[model samples]
Each structure stands twice: as structure tokens, then as C-alpha cells.
Target: MSDGHPFRGNWVARMYERVRKCGYDSLTAFAEARPTASLEELADELGPDDIAAVQVFSGLVAEAERSGKVTRLVRGQLVRELAENLPDGWPAVLDDEVRFAVAEALGFWSAYTPETHKERVKQARAALRATPPPPGWRPLGPDDELLLTLLPDEEV
Candidate 1:
């Protein structure tokens, strides 16, 4: 890690140690605390030089899987993506800029989505594009009213 790269050593232990250092017992709790923060933002907060965004996400996914809360994680990820890509929230109209921003957000969200929820996340993403949310709509958290309506909790 002396070379200034974030990926090095036992990534699992490294990430979790950083997460604990931030006063968070679980990665999801830390992530959900700042629902709108991008993965890069979270990683940077943990350790810009030793923690990468992917490590944060990997820890999040593993925790979510173990806790049967992957859907919540997926939605939370969407919140992060939206905040990063749509600083102005949903556009007033679906112009070129809006489409590109939305695409970037959705693309990154989809990438983070787990295989178990890929199809459902895809459907949710399609629904959003087919019928965009209101202008200036920015979800503050994963439990946002509109988000829950689009992709409700399904784990039993």
C-alpha cells in the first residue's frame, strides 16, 4: 500500500478494521448512516489511501447477504448513485443531460446489484426510466417512499 493504492493485503480485514475505526460495527450501518454518500466518499472517509470503494461495497454486500437485507442494500446503493449522478435531483425534463445522468446512476447501481436481486433491480430501474420520478426528486434514504413503492421488501 506504500505505492498509494487502495487494494492490498487481506482486503476483508483491512476494510472491516477501517469500518470499525470509523465507529461503525457493520458496514451497512455506516453506509446507511450516510445514505446518499457515494462509495468513493465512504471509502475516502474510511481511508483514502488504504480503502477502495469496491472494498466498502464488497463488505456491504457480504453483510447484507448474511443478514437477509440485500434489497435494502441495493436500494441504498441507488440512493448513493442518484446523489452522485443527479446532484440536481431528477431533471425537469428527459433531455440529453438527464438521460446521461440517469444512465450513469442506473448503470452504477446495476453494477453494484447482487446476482440474486439483479432481475428485480433491473425491473425497478426500467420502471423508473419508463415513468420517471417527479422533477427535483431526490431520495434521502433507502426507505424513501417512492423507492419502497418501486421495490418493496420481499425477503421473508
Candidate 2:
């Protein structure tokens, strides 16, 4: 897995080309089709040899920013991170052990967040922890009700 997508030649162009070949007009479309797939899985689907997860995310972020849908992307990222780190979904309990797992997932989401949205993501994280969504609140996609409620689209 190339950390920064060391692939030569316009990597973003290549990424979009692969996405189009997969019958999707954008990376978001391809990713939305399999919302829970990890970044690594998305990259592997695009091009295992040259594409990387970070590249998949980079392209997605660029598209999202241009479309003024960064909030949606942030929520989608949380879903992906949770899916990968908490495969069984949010636990029904909030015990110390479970707390760590939850923190780990959120931490990764924060780490992957775009710089401009870092502060907003931090606030969202706090709200999620404070409210503590129901026992098993596993969001299948970015449009999940709670996510929208917590972090409404500031762009619009």
C-alpha cells in the first residue's frame, strides 16, 4: 500500500479514469455503492498495483470540497472508520473496553479529516460522545439522520 499514492502520472486523473471505468462518474459514487468498505478496499477495487487508500480519500475529499459537501464526506468517513474498526457495529454497552474501541474509531476518523474541517469534526465527535447514540447506532451512510442532526451542512 503506497502511503501517498506514489504512482507516476496524474494519479488523480488515473483515479477518476478507473472510477469511470467502474461505471461511476465520481469516486463518491463508487464509494457510496459500497459505503462500508474500508479505504483500502476501495483502493484495491480501483487499482491494487498503483492506487492507494490515501489516494482514494484524496480524490474523494477534492470532489467533496468542490461540491461543498465536506460535511457529508466527514460523516461518511466516520461510517467507514467505524465499519472497519468496529465490525460488529457500535456495541450495546459503553463499558471502558468498549469506550476504547469507540475512541479508536473516532480517532482514525479525526486523523483522516481534512484540515479545514478538523475543528468541525472535533465538535461532532464531542457531540456524539455526549449524546451517545442509542445502544447500537451504526450509520450505513452519510445521510444517517443523527449525523445530519449533529453536523448539518454548513455550506448551504
Candidate 3:
């Protein structure tokens, strides 16, 4: 059925605009409220001329979830493996300062137990000072922010 309004393009543009003005979840819920229809159906009824935006948004959500899960799994595995490989009495063997540095380098401690990890890091650092890790280690820094800023935004 023709949308009574004279507008000719797909109405998903309006949805996208709404998302830009409000938020993605809000627009998604708003779109979903017209439950009897699929995204294409809703687009046709609302006057959106194309489904590109909907397709893009859907793809983005799927990709992000997939990527997040994969990265989480890999990082978790690495953390477990590293923790297992450390010499017995890891904290005691490494100096406090060196332990902290190692923990920071590992990057797995950002979750709920961060402070505990940091404390362990300090202990490890103290022990490690006596026998430093081979020279290539250095603190990660601010340039990474540029990479983060360059990532694309999701749109639908």
C-alpha cells in the first residue's frame, strides 16, 4: 500500500534520522513497534526508498557482536595460558615494580579484578627487576587513541 504521504524515498531514512537525533536502540524499538511488518515492509509503508541503511545497521550489529566475542575468547585464552606459564611463586620471583609492569603489558586485567591484578603486577615487577624481561618491552601509549577515533560509526 502506498504511504499516503507524498514523500517518495524509503521511510528508513526517517528512521535513520530519528536514530541520529535520538539513538539507535530507540529507533530500533520504534521500528519494531510496527511488529506486523519487517524492515522492508516498514520502509515501504513509511516511504523509505531504499533498504541500505537497515541492511548496513543489521550487518554492523552482527559484526560487532562477532568480533567482540572472538576477541574476548582469544584474550581470555592468552591470559589463562600466560598465568599458567609463569614460574612458581610468580609474584615473589618478580619484583613489585616489574610485576605491575608485566600485568599492564598483559592487558587482560581491565575487568572487575583490575586492582588485584595491579597489585600482583607490582609484586611481579619487584621480582622481575633482578632478571628483567628481554629488552623490547615498553609502555603502550596515546597514539592508539587515533586508531580508536578512526573506527567507523554504525548507522541505519
Candidate 4:
């Protein structure tokens, strides 16, 4: 998987294609269509690679949010799905880069205001911290600087 990316494999690619083939133009659309679908159901449909599905979903969500294709409501739904579905010891399956990407996306989406956004960031960090990487795996910390840079002075 691209030397080190845990999510850049045939399975994840196939999952993306399957989402496209399901009459959805993008992953965001697929997520929007099944707002109530559990993550377990999605993972089951994608194959046995639930970890890869999570990674791919996170990446897709990040891309959609960055592109302005995902609205606040949809973003919230996706984030909630992530929080609810990820399995125990899930962090062990992810590499530092993937973790950083996820943190970046969460941080970006969580930026709402000085007060509320700060609380969101705190919660995101706590969640990430709770899942430590596997033994000997060097975990990357969240990119707070990037989040700060992306967040505007005034809330949008």
C-alpha cells in the first residue's frame, strides 16, 4: 500500500468504486444517502477489511469537507459514525500518517468558534489520545498548527 499507507490498497479502492457504482457521485453522497447506516454494515459490505474502510471513509470525509461538498449536518453525521463504529484497539491498525490525516480532518471540521471549537478540539484530541498506537509504533500528534491556520479569525 504505497510503501506505508495502510489505506491505499486494492480493497479500499474497490470500496470507493463500489460507492460510486451505487449511484452516488461521491463518498459524501453515499454517506448522505444512508445517514442511519451503521459503520458495521458499511464495513461488512466493503469486505473483511473494516480498518481499511474506516481509513478510506475518513479520507473521503476529509476530502469532501475540504472541497465544501459536505455540509455541517453531514459532517456531524460522519463524525458520529466514526465515533460509534470504530472497534476497540482500532488505533493499532493505523499508522502515524493516517492518524495525522484523521486528526487534521477532525480538527478542521471541529472549528466552529473560539469557545465551541476549542471544546470540539479538546474532545477530538482526547478521543485520539485514548487509542494509543501499537507497540513500537511511533504515533503522530494532532496538527494543531494546521487546524489553527485553517480556522479563520472569525467563525464562519
Query: Model 1, 61: alpha-carbon shift in Å?
Result: 0.3
Q: How close is each model in CA RMSD to the real structure? A: 1.5, 2.8, 18.3, 12.5
Candidate 3: give its CA RMSD in angstroms: 18.3
Per-model TM-score, in order, reads 0.94, 0.90, 0.23, 0.40
Using TM-score as the measure, which candidate wins? 1
- Model-by-model lDDT, in order? 0.88, 0.88, 0.37, 0.47
What tens digits encode model 2's per-residue C-alpha lDDT throughout 103-146? Answer: 99999999999998999899989998777887677899998998
How many residue pairs clash in each candidate at the backbone level?
0, 0, 26, 0
Runs with alpha carbons beyond 4 Å of true place in candidate 2: 1-6
Q: Which ten residues in a row have the lowest lDDT in candidate 1?
A: 1-10
Better of 1 and 4 by lDDT: 1
Which portions of model 3 miss their true places by more than 4 Å? 1-15, 18-25, 52-156
Minimal lDDT window, size 10, model 4: 138-147
**Tens-digit lDDT track of model 4 for 20-80:** 7778766666655555444455555544443354554565556555665333333343344
Q: Candidate 3 versus the native: TM-score?
A: 0.23
Our model 4 lands, by Cα RMSD against the true structure, at 12.5
The superposed Cα distance between candidate 3 and the true structure at residue 68, in angstroms, equals 11
